[model samples]
Target: MSSLGGQPILILKEGSQRTRGRDAQSGNIAAAKAVASAVRTTLGPKGMDKMLVDTIGDVVITNDGVTILKEMDIEHPAAKMMVEIAKTQDDEVGDGTTSAVVIAGELLKRAEDLLDQDVHPTVIAHGYRIAADKAQDILNEIAIDIKPDDIEMLKKLAETAMTGKGAEAAKEKLTELVVKAVTMVADADGTVDTEYVKVEKRVGGSIEDSEIVEGMIIDKERVHPAMPRIVKDAKILLLNAAVEFKKTEVDAEISITSPDQLQMFLDEEERMIRGIVDKIVASGANVLFCQKGIDDIAQHYLAKAGILAVRRVKKSDMEKLARATGAAIVSSIDAIAPEELGKAGTVEEKKVSGEEMIFVTECENPKAVSIIIRGGTEHVVDELDRAIEDALRVVSVAVEDKKFVAGGGAPEIELSLRLREYAATVGGRAQLAIEAFANALEIIPRTLAENAGLDPIDMLVALRASHEKGGANAKYMGLDVFNAASGDMLKAGVVEPLRVKTQAVSSAAEAAIMILRIDDVIAASKSSAPAPGAEDMGDMGGMGGMPPM
Candidate 1:
């Protein structure tokens, strides 16, 4: 007779073997389908938000599919694979995590159906690739060639991307600025250099004098009482590090023992600083870009001496500015030259209560320019700063590449339809795989539907059928992907996937098919074993519910 523990273990092994009899392909398909179903209803701008609650009771709410997938504590091996697809999508587009996974799941589901009919996996993969290529073609056909004159459309696109993130008006304004900045840097080679535009925030007031500068702007006031306020034919000095002398051991401890001693210390400090500034001026330098700190007394002296100085220049900014202006950072001020003095065009200051805003423009062939964004509150300024940053990046990409697809869920939807067409031509197993790829593309619409609490399965089927019948079109709207009938989907109030039937169905189908193709699972063993006598032994009583060997 077998021991109790050993006998139970034997029985478990038998049961496992019996369960393992199922085909690996079918198992993978099923797992993918499950994951696809989870995020099907949260796709479009009208898409509802997902509330993820962790075991610790912490909650996060957002409509970003990528964020949702990342936060989920996924345990299933198949489900984890789907999450990776979402991650890849997010990295590429900065959005559309849900759509990629959803379409992938749908593709898998369709593949499973094809597999059941004896289609080969290799054929399905080939079909899927063909479909993807075709889908790209379709996208090109539908893409609206955005021109530089279409500033309004650009604004709308930027607004759509930043709608729920806060500060709508600011976002639009910043978008316009980004477009202008990009236009400024457009080269003969058709490339836009983003290195020229810099978004900076300082403690000063608003920029009243926002003129184009040929040279770099320095935020610091004059270095010394003797430094000149304005200098013509200014020789500019760019320093990568600080000019202040290090404190000696005796200098730190010295107190005002006598008026003579105090005056001597002050005079020494001033002399040291002024000597450096004088050296710079003697070298024919009128302006200075200091990466590190400058002495207060020295600034006063420099100002009195008719020299202009800018302190705390970042190393990267210094390099760019230097390259653009043909100015070099020298170790000693004696190397500066009047010929090297880039012209300073305009410099003005505005005051807002305790804050002062300085506008410096028209410097010597300056490449890097700074836009110091200021606001009353930290949150307000931060939000404005972010909007400006996004606008700059988008405009830069648009100007540089002159080719890009609508970001977010739009691309995924297009991918699904293309995959479907290819799936029809492939052999049995290959058809299944192609269908799976198509389904993965559907996750976007399904996610939209689920967010709206609609039935993802029904919507996905409808979407697939609609695309199969050719009822979709692309155009300029608030969001990248919007149904023609929905007006402005991104701006119009949040919509459920079920409410927008076409999007719902399409997204669900795509997600389901994509998820249905996963076939393998590898599980790691637990590090620790159960406690002694803690295992369940089942019923000890005989006859009715007794443990049996």
Candidate 2:
């Protein structure tokens, strides 16, 4: 609003409210910090899990950072930006989401302290950008390079990812499977897509019962009970076309006045289905996987021909089957040929947990593999699935990058130590912001300590002392939550991919800089009269425009 000769111009609507300058900055910062704090405790090996129950009473029991943030019902803009940081970090590296959010929260907290000292927001933003770039450099300097064929290091990386999750109950077995699955599906060029590694979960078994299948596993069973349950030396066919009669493009009424005509129509339909079955038989394919449904007559003919078939298979599974069994998906029945059929050692129908699933295993050389994860309960299975996904993703990333770092807050402490030294070299108001960033990086170790029920201050001091001593192994020093002391993380086999740390640092710094620069917040009125706490809490509580309770 502006004034003209003492008369209000009322540029905005009468009830709309605006918060400017210091108030706006503080409001956005507080909201963003609250979001980060929500998931801060769910960090490290000893971290806790959050059981989030939605309005419909469905429960999500896990501590995966991205999952938790996604479950929250946040309404504030700044808070949403904080969630984006976790999401981006998770998407890029598949781990370190909790550290990213916590670091971002601590960065804003320190920025608040600097704001009180008369440091401009722009200076803080500029210094954070500089510190972020330098932090990446320091991270790369401390990273250790490994070969793609280094199975032990890859296993350590996978174990590090699944340590804090519920999969820890059988981490050794699951870790081995994760590493094997990832390595099996990796290309010769050292590129791993992680999609070819499939995870299929089922209840009514112990966690240790999970095993990796050498080929694809389709969830559907045989269309006809009379079909052979097992096919040895299986020749597989992948079909996208439906086995049922094709329906007309437009709706039409069939006038059946004579019984003879109706019999002829039925006979034609049977003949067509028989023709389709004949083509599949001539292709020398003992096993059939179809993306579309199969008619009853077609199933009977296929069973009579001693062929095992599964209908209505998912499109994704079909693609995987093509890769796993070395088959091409034929769209038309006429195109079926012996050369187009895929080869597999055996295809069988197995009953798991009282449900039938087709297992196409023992392929000659499968590019795609499946892991069947069995658990005792639904919640256990769900959590295990999440843990395996994280493990698989981290292993793939490590294999592709061929670089890793020590976990358990080791990289953060090393980065902080080096960044502070760099801060002193660039002495200015920006130096203070750079130093603030250095302190903010410590939040990872501090949170790790606090979540572990240890003395954070004492641990930080000891960690710093070790880094200052500056030996060949000094940079790898990290707090051991299990032992309640500082030790060399690399020697203890606590390793993670370098990409996780780099992605976390860059994302955290960028989010902090974005939230710090907001100097104004404008909210439109929701009612004719203002409600109590509406103006203040609406902007600061991350629940903008919600009526006061």
Candidate 3:
């Protein structure tokens, strides 16, 4: 309160909390760095996994960075911003969530040093921007082109993505499935659509039992037990229309004057059902997949006609079946025709873990496919699903971009070197920021080394010296966490899509810059407790609805 005019000035709410200037910066940086440290150890091929148990005691064990951060239950706003960087990385590139967060943490760590030296945040942000741009250019320059049909390279990419997870034990088999799935979904225009590749997991068998189906797998069972368990040379019909008698959209009143009238009404309904069945039969469809409910009478007719039918299929599964079987989804039974039927080698209901599942397989040159994942337990299968999901996305990225870079922290070291050289030309306090940015990039390799139980300083020094050797082959050298030695990632069969590197760097830098610019944090206190004396008149402390026990 100011006493100048014997008056009081109240600007902010009494309970509102505020922190500004250097305090705000340091608090935010500390929060961001703390978040980074949480995921830092889960960064490489030998990275350890985190077992997160939720409020319900449900456990999640995985080393995937995004999964770890997502399960942390973070509450601090600045820490949540760091989580956003991981999410953005995951969404954009499907890999490198750890690298992005680690870089963001290191950037903020460096920025704190610069802040202490009185270098303006704006200047540091500008220098980081330059460093980020140069890093992307260096990434592109270092990336090698891969043929979309290069199965070997694609296998390496998929294996690299799956190595540290539960799927590593069977990555060779899983890689083949990934490649096949990707290849099947790649259109003639070279665009890969991952949606067409479905992953279905069931816990029982080993991971090696996982295989790619040439067509889609509908999780539903056959509608009728009398229906054939298997159909060969199946002519599949994809139907969106309901097989039962649909109710009238508008409200209606029906009065049956006699019992015979009710019988006649049911007879009419039966005739309509028979008519629909006749249309499907005439269309040469031996198998039926319905998106809507199928009446019992319809199933009987279909089974009698030697046709297999599965009902209550999901809309997504219906779409995938169409792509896999080359069938067109027909809405009306009257429009059914021979040309509308899709062909498949077999439509069979097989018991998987005692639960029946419909497998539509052997579609010639199918545009869509499914990967059936089998594991000894639910957790293993779930982790494998996550691993393969990453592989699928990264493989698609490589196919779409037709470019990949070596993994194992090689690119970070190479970029750090190039960025430092570029920093020299831009002389000023900004140069120090650039140098800090360059130093920040090394965290990837250093963390990789530390997580593998190796000396980070020695590994980084050896890595930098190897890069300084300057050759096409040496450029591919990176810290091999598996052996705790520097090796050629390219020859070691460790590769990643180029987009992962570029997107990780850009997103981390962007997030760091955004966090650096904040000068104040004003948090309004939560609403005050309910007004006093608002309790009900009938207040009984667990005795009864009476005043006393």
Top TM-score: which candidate number? 3
Which digits, one per residue and each the tens of the lDDT, describe model 3 over residues 1-549? 235587787667778788999999999999999999999988888888899999999999898999999999998899999999989988877888999999999999999999999999999999999999999999999999999999999999999999888787887899999998998899998899898999999999898899888998888899999999999999999999988876889999989999999999999999989989998899889999999889999999999999899888999999999999999999987788999989999999999878889999989879989999999988898889889988999999999999999999999999999999999999988899999999999999999998889999999999999999998788799988878889999999999999999999999999999999999999887777654664553455566555552
Candidate 2 per-residue C-alpha lDDT over 1-549 given as tens digits, one digit per residue, 9 for 90 to 100: 999999988877778889999999998999989988899989999999999999999999999999999999899889999999989988888988988999999999999999999899999999999999999999999999989889998999999999989888898999999998998899999999888988998998899899999998888999999999999999999999999877789998899999999999999889989999999999898999999999999999999999999999999999999999999999998899999999999899999999999999999888999999999999999999989999999999999999999988888899898999999999999999999999999999899999999999999999999889998999999999999999999999999999999999999999999999989888887666667668664544435665545
TM-score of each: 0.60, 0.94, 0.95
Compare candidates 1 and 2 on lDDT and give the better one: 2
Off by over 4 Å in 1: 1-43, 47-130, 144-153, 193-195, 201-236, 244-275, 295-297, 306-308, 323-326, 331-334, 348-358, 363-367, 371-387, 404-415, 445-549
Could you give the candidate ranking by TM-score, starting with the highest? 3, 2, 1
Off by over 4 Å in 3: 1-6, 528-549
Give the Å shift of residue 272 in candidate 1. Answer: 6.8
Question: What TM-score would candidate 3 get against the native?
Answer: 0.95
The whole-model lDDT of each prediction reads 0.54, 0.92, 0.92
Minimum summed lDDT over a 10-residue window in model 2 is located at: 539-548
Lowest lDDT sum, 10 consecutive residues, model 3, at: 534-543
- What lDDT does model 3 reach? 0.92
Of the candidates numbered 1 and 3, which has the greater TM-score value? 3
- lDDT digits (tens) for residues 324-406 of candidate 1: 45677665555555555444555444343454333445665455566556655554455455445544555554444444344
